[model samples]
Every structure is written in structure tokens, then in C-alpha cells.
Target chain A: MIRIEDVSLRHGQTQILHDIWLTIPKGGITALVGPNGAGKSSLLSLIARLQPLQAGRISVDSFPVDTTPSRDLARILAILRQDSIVTSRLRVRELVGFGRFPHGRGRLTPDDYAIIDQSLQQFDLTDLSDRFIETLSGGQRQRALVAMAFAQGTDYLLLDEPLNNLDMFFARELMRSLRRIADENGKTIVIVLHDINQASAHADRIVAMKSGRIVADGTPSDLLTPKTLQAVFGFQMRVETFDDMPVVLHFR
Target chain B: MSIAATKQASKTGWVAGLTLAVLFVFSLCVGVDDMPIIRLFSDGRALELLLVSRLPRTLAAILTGAGLAIAGLIMQTLARNRYVEPSTAGTAQSAELGILLVTLLLPSASLLFKSLAASAAALLGTSLFLMTAHRLPPTQPFLVPLFGLVYGGVIGAAVTFVAWQADLLQYLSVWTNGDFSGVLRGRYELLWLGALMVVVAWMVADRLTIMALGRDASIGLGLDHARMLQLGLIIVSVISALSVVVVGMIPFVGLVVPNIVSRLMGDNMRGTLPTVAVSGAILVLGCDILGRLIRYPYEIPVGTVMGCVGGLIFLWLLFRRPSHV
Candidate 1:
């Protein structure tokens, strides 16, 4: 379980996240959907300890984020931050292998390599494993990044916009991959997503945010109505059912 | 991407090691008052010269080369910029400034004192550059190195002005021009300290490689990013300062060698560090030999030759496709 209590973030003079309290239980996919500047990424970063918490308490399992040793916390929690750019000339397998660092400290055992290869296979990246990351297309690189985070072997994963740069086919494939991992491995996944329909389809729970505050939080059927969507996004959009799922017609 | 390529990279590594060995032997051979290969067994005076001058000079060249190349690799990781090395980023100039100021204050200070002063100033300068370089728009990556060039130029000009006011121009020239002709048995042992920094770097090679992934990624990977950064700063500053103190300022060995090796062997420092070290040693040794042969009787400074050779390679690095971004 990941717990966040009374979390607030301020950047310069602006309040980015205001008294945000969220508790995510172990297993399942929780999608944080919001408009721009809604503090989804900021909240995720604070929980992941990517940035120092200003006024909050966050813990993964029983370990306090503020006081926990990074290595210890990393063995349990992995994060894929938005805007993560790797400029190094690294092959895909080697890059994914970096995820095992906290465990092996760069001296990877055969077991660690198996985990890396498994991650590559999970993301359908086994063939592209030896390709340089720079040579991969943007979508392929995004999948590689996601694969690396998965290779960390952490129970709880915090991904900020992992679907960015991915085309429709890969994006849906990635969401399905997340769903498979969440179901089979019982991994606790918290994802920040932009496309509402994607969240409505794959997310077990959707937490909608607006103006640095959570406006609505519940299952997609209850929380993703047009009224809540308008309140969260400041615009009206029709939410209809397709194949027993809420397919949000957000387009004009 | 194939087993063949991996085999080929190792092949290249072996070939580079061989080339470096050949260059090391050739460097020992090309000095003035040449001792033939048989002279060591035949003549005692020639043997004494080899131990006192040739051996020390060659070792210092190799050590300084390896040290600065590793330093450059670390700096690039820490700064997250490929183009900034010690000489281009005001580190070497800051060391020169610190030495100049210390000399003006106390003309009779010990060599240790001078080196400490140089390292301190170098640390400050490098940290300042790394801090500011990130603030510039990273979209145009050339801007960081360009700012670094100007920053190094400003520090260098300040050093020159101070030296001129005190009429220490000759002293300045001796310290600024990198030449190993003055190296003797006990004189150049400070580079061994720089070599120790390399060993420490190799010990923490994985952490340094993680740093290339940037701060957030490094922290996410469970590295103590701030501590690793401090270690990297100390390593670069100490190596740059030691080289400046011992051999004046050898330009481009740091910048040129690391990039070439990275292009060939990727960024895993643990896998590529030895290659980077050997490649750097070979470049410097080869340049020193070229400086010897380019003018037979009178020797050209190694720094001057490197400025030409490294500058051309640097231009090629600048204008190349940049390895597909």
C-alpha cells in the first residue's frame, strides 16, 4: 500500500498541490486523470520521493519516504517520471538492466539478467533489446523506459504519463501490459494519464483533479460522468457505455 | 546489435590496447639523445637517462592522460553535457588562477600548497559551471559549451592580467604550456595521486554511469545523487589541478578521447573505462611523440600539438550527425 497524507506542494508563489491526501491500496491500476497544471505529476513525484516533500507524509508499505534510505525505498517503489531524457549511448537491454541496480549494484547475477529479459519480453522488446536507445523511435523508447521501470521488481510503481509519445497500437498494448502485470503479479500501479478514455477503459479507479485539488475520486462508472468530467476539466463531454466500459467522447 | 558487433567491440578494444602499447614503446624511443633499443643493456648512462627522464615523462603522460579522460567522462555525466571538459569549462583556467594568486601571495609556498589551492579553485569553478550550464536552454546544446568557452576565456584573461602586473609572465608561460621535457624521477609523482582518483572512479564506475541518466533518474535508481555529484566534482578538480601543476595545461585529451570511446563502446562506465583510459594515454603519448618529431632539434609543446589535433577532432565531433541525437 502507498499512503499520502496532507501533501502540499508550492512552486515559487504558486500552489501546485493543496492538502492532497490519497491512499492507494496494493494491486490494481489507479489512474490520476486531470487537466494541465492539476498537480498530478507533482503529487506522483512527491510520493515517489523524486522531489523533497514540503508538507506531507508518504510511505510505501511501512517505510517513510522522507527518512527511508533511497536504496531500501527503491527496492519497493519504482517511478517513471515525465520528461526523463537519457542522452547516453546505451543499448536497450543495458538500459533496462539499470533497473536492477538497487539489487545487484551493477554486478548483475544470472537471476537479474533473467528479470531484465523477462521485462523486455513483457514489453515486447526482446528483439529490440540490443538496439541503441537513440536509434529507437520515440514510442519504442517510451516502451523501453516503461520496461526498465518494470524491471526494477518493485511492488509499487509510480508512472507519470508513461503513455506519452506512444502511438495508438503501442499505447493500448502498454495499457494491456500494465493490466496483465497488475492482475498476474499483483503489482500496485499508479499512473498519471491524459486521455480520459484510456483511463476509463483500463483504470480500476480514476481520481480527477482540478486547481491543485481532487474534485472527484471513485470507480469509472460513478466518477467519470459528464458532470464530474465538466467539473474536473472545465468543459462538457459526453460519457457513454461501450462494451460495458465508459467510452468518453471527449472530442469536438 | 548482433553477436558480431559485440565481438567487434571487443576486437576494437584489443586493437586499441595493442595500439596504446605500441605508442607507449614508441614514446619511450623518440626523445632527444635517443638511446637505441640495445642501449639499456649496453650503457649505464643511457640507462640512467631512461630511468630519470624518459620513463618518468612517459608514465606522467600516460597517467595524466588517463586521469583527465576519466575526469572528463565523469564531468560529462555530472553536468549531463557532452562538450564540456576541464580545459573548456574553466576548471584548468581556475587552477591556473589559483596557482597565480597563491604564488603572488607567497613566492616560496610548497608544491603541495599550490596544488591544494589549485584544486580548491578548480572545484569552485567547475561546480559553478555545472550549476549554470544546466540553466541555459538545453534545446540548443551548443550553448552550454559556448558559455563554458567564454567562462574559461574570462578566467584565463584574469590570470594573464594578474601575472602581467607582477611580471610573472615567464612563470605563467612555464605553467600554461604543457610539456613533459621537465619531468624527472621525483618531480612528476603527483600524477600518481591523479591515478589514484582514477582507481576510485573505477570502484564507483556504476554509480557514475547511472549519473548519465540525469538527477531524477539517478535518484530513482537509489543512488545518492548529491554525494555522487560531490565525489565526481572532487575527482575532476583534483585530476585537473594535478595535471595543471605537473605538466602545465594539456588541452583536448579529456574532451577528445572520451567522446571517441563513448561513440565506440557506449556509456556503461564499468564496461568502457579501461578503454577510455588506454585510448587517452595513447593519444597523449602519440601527440608528445609527434611534437618531438615535428621539430627534431627544438621540441614543440605537447599542448600546442594537441590544440591542433584535438581541435580538428573536436570540430568533427561538433559537426557530425551527433550519433543520431
Candidate 2:
């Protein structure tokens, strides 16, 4: 379970998050959806301990984020931010192998190799394992990065816009993979998504944020109505049922 | 994508092997006298010169190259940018200025004092850069180097102004050119400290690699981000300053060598490190040999040759598609 308590973030009189309190459960997918300037990324960063917390406390699986050792936190939670760019000349296998760094350091034991290969296969990147990351297409590269995050073997995965740069096919495939991981492995996945329909389809719970506070949080069916969507996105959204799931038609 | 090409390519290993062999042979053969390479071991004075002078100079070049490359690798990793290196931080120039100031202040200062002063100055310059630019985005890697270049130029101009006033420009110019000709048993011993740094860097390779992912990534992975960055920066500054002290500023030995090696060997800090060290040694030694061959009796300084070569290569690199990025 991830718990955030009275978290208030301010950067020199500009408050980014205000008294934000949220409790994210241990399993299944939780999509953090919000409009622009909603502080979704900042809140996620604080949860991942990417930035120091200014005026609140957060804990992951009973370990306090501020006091926990970095290695310990890394083993517990893995985060893939949208703007993470590595300019080093690295092969896909090597980048994925870095996911296992906290466990084996640099020496890849047989077990580490197994995990790396599993991650590569899971992301459908086994063929491109030896290829340099720079040579891969954007969709392929995004998959590789997601695969690396998976290879970290953490129980909780905090992904900030993991679907960026992915094509429709790849996006659905990625969401499916996350769903399978969540269901089969019982891993806790928290993803920040821009596309409301994608979140509605895959997310077990949808949390909507506006003006640095979560305005709504409930099951996808309960919280994804046009009324809530209107409040969250500032526009009316058409909702329909498809195969017993909510399909939001917000394009118009 | 190019693993097949990498497997088929013998260029890297071949270059390393050929350069090492050529440097060894030339260092043994070429000197002040007309003593043939075959007769050196038998002749007493020739043997003395070979063991006492040429061998140490060769080792110093190799060690300095290795040290500088390691320093560059650390800096690039810490900054999370391919273009960053120790020399880009005005470290080498600061080190030179520190030595010059120490010499002027105390004419009878010990070699240790001069080196320590240079190292402290380099550390100070690096800290100043960090303090100023720490808040800026790391994507603009060139800003630090540009700042460093301007800082170095200012120091250089200041040194020149002082030297001109004191009428010691000739002495200063000689030191600045960075010739390894004076390296011998006692004089070159200080460089072994840089070799020690190479070992230390290798030991911390995993931590450095984690640190390369950025402060947040490293912290998320349960490492002390600030302390790790501090440790890496310290290693970078110390090695760079020490290398400058051992052999004057060998331009681009840090930037070009590590970059080339990383492309061939991939960015795993462990694999790329040894290659960078060897490649740096080969490059410096090869350039030094070229210097020896061109002016046989009157040696052109190694720094001048390196500067000319590095300038051309840097221009070429700019035009070419960056392999690292």
C-alpha cells in the first residue's frame, strides 16, 4: 500500500500540490488522470521520491520515503518518467540489464540474466535485445524502457506517461501487459495517463486530479461518468458501454 | 542493430594493439643520441637513459592518458551528458594557474605543495561551476564547458598578464606546452597517484553507473544521491588536476578517447573504462611519437600536436552524426 499524507509542495510561493492526501491500494492498476497543470507528475514524483518532499510524508509498504535507503526504495518501487533521456551508447540488453543493478550490481548472475531475458520476452523485445537503443524506433524504444522498468522486479511500478510515443497497437499491448502483470503477478501498478478512454478501459480505479488535488476517486464505472468527466476535463464527454466496460467518447 | 558489424570489426582491437606495439618500439629506439635500438641495452649510458628517462616518460604518458580518460568518464556520467568531461570544467587550466601561482608566491615550494595547490584550485573551480549551474537543466551539457572555457581563458589571460609583468613568459610557455620529455624516475613518480585513481574508479563503477541515471533515479534505487555525486565529482577533479600536474594539458585526450571507446564497447561503465584507458594511452603515445619523428633533434611538444589533431577531430565529430546521443 502507498500512503500520502497532507502532502503540500511549494516552490517559492507557488504551491504545486496542496494538502494532497491519497491512499493507493496494493494490487491492480490505478490510473492517475488529470488535465494540464493538475500536478499529476509532481505528485507521482513525490511518491517515487524523485523529488524531496517539502511538507508532508509518504510511505510505500510501511517504509517511510524520506528515511528509507535509496536502494531499499528502488527495490520496492520502480518509476519510469516521461522525460527520462539517456544519451549513453547502450544496447537494449544492457539498458534492460540495468534494471537488475540494485540486485546484482554490475555482475550479471545467472538469475539476473534470467530476469533480463524474461523482461525482454515479456516486452516482445527478445529479437532486438542486442540492438542499440538509439537505432530503435520510438515505439520500440518506449517498449524497451517499459521492459526495463518491469525487469526491475519491484512490487510497485509508478509510470508517468508510459504510453507516450507508443502507437495504438503498442499502447493496447502495453496496457494489456500491465493488466496481466497486475492480475497474474499481483503487482501494484500506478500509471499517469492522458487518454481518458485508455484509463477507463484498463484502470481498475481512476483518480482524477485538478488544481493539485484529487477531485474524484472510485471505480472506473462509478467515477468515469459524463458529469465527473465534465468537472475533471471542463468539457462534456459522451459515455457508452462496450462489452460491459465504459468507453468514453471525448474526442468531440 | 550493428552487433554483427561490431563482431566483424577488428578496427578497435587492432588499433589498440598496433599503437601499443609502435609506441613501445619507438620509445625504446628514439632519444637524444644516434644510438641504434639494438645497441641500447649493451651500452651503459644508452641503457641508463633508456631505463631512467624514456621508460618513465612513456609510462607517464600512458598513465596520464588513462587518468584523464577515467576522469572524463566520471564527469560525463555524473553530469548525465555525453559531452561533459573534466577539462570542460576549467579544471586543467585552474590546476595550471594554481601551480603557476604557487611557484610565483614561493619560489622554493615543494613539488607536493604545487600539486596540492593545483588540485585544490581545480576542486574550487569545479565547485564554483556546480554551485552556479546546479539548478539548470542537465540537457544543455555544453553550458558548463562553455562557462569553463571562458573561466579558463580568463585565468590564462591573467597568468599571461602576470608573466609579462615579471618577464617569465618563456618559462610559463614551456610548462603550458605539456611535454613529457622531462619525465624520469623521481619526477614521474607523482603520476602513479593517478593510476591509483583508475583502480578506485573501477571499484566504484557500479555506483557510478547508477549515479549516471540522474539523482532521482539513483535515489529511487536506494542510493545516497548527493553523496554518490560528490564522490564521483571528487574523483573527477582529483584525477584531472593530477594529470594536468603530471603532464601539461593534453587537449581532448579526455573527451575524444572515452567517446570513441564508448561507441565501440557500449556504455557499461566497466567494459568501456578499460578500453578508454588503453585508447587514451595509445593516442597520447602515438602523438608523442609523431612529435619525435617530425623534429628529430628539436622535439615539438606533445600538447601542440594533440591540440592540432584534437581540433580537427572535434570538427569532424561535430559534422558527423553523434554515435553516443
lDDT of 2 by residue, B20-68 (tens): 8778777767777665667776788878877788888888888887888
Best by DockQ: 1
**Candidate 1 residue-wise lDDT, B154-254, digit = tens:** 99999999999999999998778788888899999989999999999999998998899988888898999999999999999999999999899888988
Model 2 score (lDDT):
0.81
When summed lDDT is taken over every stretch of 10 residues in candidate 1 chain B, the lowest stretch is B316-325
Clashing pairs in 2: A70-B221, A70-B222, A70-B223, A71-B221, A71-B222, A71-B223, A131-B1
Q: How many clashes would you count in candidate 2?
A: 7
Write down the C-alpha DockQ for each prediction. 0.73, 0.55
Q: Each candidate's chain B TM-score?
A: 0.96, 0.89
- Output the lDDT of residue B198, model 1: 93
Best by lDDT: 1
